[model samples]
Target: MDTPALIADDLVVLRGGRKTVDGASLTVAPGEIYALLGGNGAGKSTTLFAILGLIKRSSGVIQVAGHDPEVAPDAVRAAAAYLPENVALYDHLSALENIRYFLGLAGQTRTGAELDQAFDAVKLAPAARTRRVSGFSKGMRQKTAIALALLRQTPVLLLDEPTSGLDPAAARDFHDLLIDLRKRRVATLMVTHDLFGAADTADRIGVLQGGRIAQEWTAAAQGPRFDIQALHQSYAGPDAA
Candidate 1:
């Protein structure tokens, strides 16, 4: 198997003297999507932040594309694209403008044609490319952000609540975009509460409970990828189930 694009080994993160992520470990292989599923305060987002080097890990190891985020944050970030729960784009700027601005910030430059191509890859409407993002729907904003990620050519993607706020049709389109990214060998690690979305999109799903990985499930070769009922029981806790 290829070296994992992302790795968190015995990961631990603390906030205010409490362990937010305690010994949570997982991996995302190139061209694979791994969904980290949990409810509120389950340390899912904390795990993502630790990988991004935004939050210092109390202990354990983290490697993004062979670079340690704590040791070489710049290199780690360069090799990864992160989309937070709320994609931050200048509402006043058009989609192309937003992409251009971010690329410039990254010290990378792309021509007009390349920018358009990225937008096309994400299936953002041609007409919307030149309009202010303030008028765009949540899905449109997500597409614009993803286009920026594509232009960066990042090998890994970290997404937090990627499918939240999207309608069924828009979510499906977003999943298709993820499939294309997988085909391009981008390893994706997404944290979400969307069980249905995770079941439909992820090659593997890890359940995070009480700040640790409680259990995990992998997709099957044929038929349904998951037993939704079982997955739900795991996610909702035995009492809730």
Candidate 2:
């Protein structure tokens, strides 16, 4: 079997002397899209941050591409590309310029043609390439972020509410891009509240409650086999189910 791209075992986090994430565990294999689903304050974003070493874990283990994020942050960062809910970009910089600058920070430099190709792969308009991101819509900004991820060619991708503000068309485009990434054996972990979108795009869905994964479901080999009603109940609470 192939090594998992991301793994968290009995992970724990504390804030204000209270457990925010308790005994949370998950594994995302290469080429698989795993959705971490939950309501607000369910510790979904916190879990992502912990995996990225942005927040220190109180206990448990985390491995990204076989490297511990805390002990080997540089290695983990090199192997993982992260896209937060609101991707920050320079307003004055053009889409292409933003990508170039960010890639440079990662010690990567690419030619204009290569950058343009990445933009194209994300379905960003050729005209938008030179346009300042200040005038771009949320979807356009997300495409630019996706383009950066493609350029980096990281083995693992982490996304936080990636489709929150996107329209149906834009969201669809993003899902297609994820599928393409999977073909390249890139693992993906997405935190989202969109049950239907998770059903449509994720290879597996893990419901988080009280900072723990309370339930999990796998997509059928033929396609997604999610029971939306049950998922809704699960989100409501254990009693609701």
| Cα lDDT, all candidates | 0.93, 0.92
Q: How accurate is candidate 2 locally (lDDT)?
A: 0.92
Candidate 2 on 1-241: residue-level lDDT in tens? 7789899999999878888899999999999999999889989999988999999999999999999989999999999999999999999999988998999999999888888889888999999899999999999999999999999989999999999999999999998998898899999999998888888888899999899999999888874478778877877765874
Residue-level lDDT of model 1, residues 106-169, one tens digit each, is 9999988988888888889899999999999999999999999999999999999998999999
Candidate 1 residue 137 Cα shift, in angstroms, is 1.5
Residue pair clashes in candidate 1: none
TM-score of model 2 relative to the true fold? 0.96
Best by TM-score: 1
TM-score of 1: 0.97
lDDT at 181 for candidate 2?
89
TM-scores of the candidates in the order shown: 0.97, 0.96
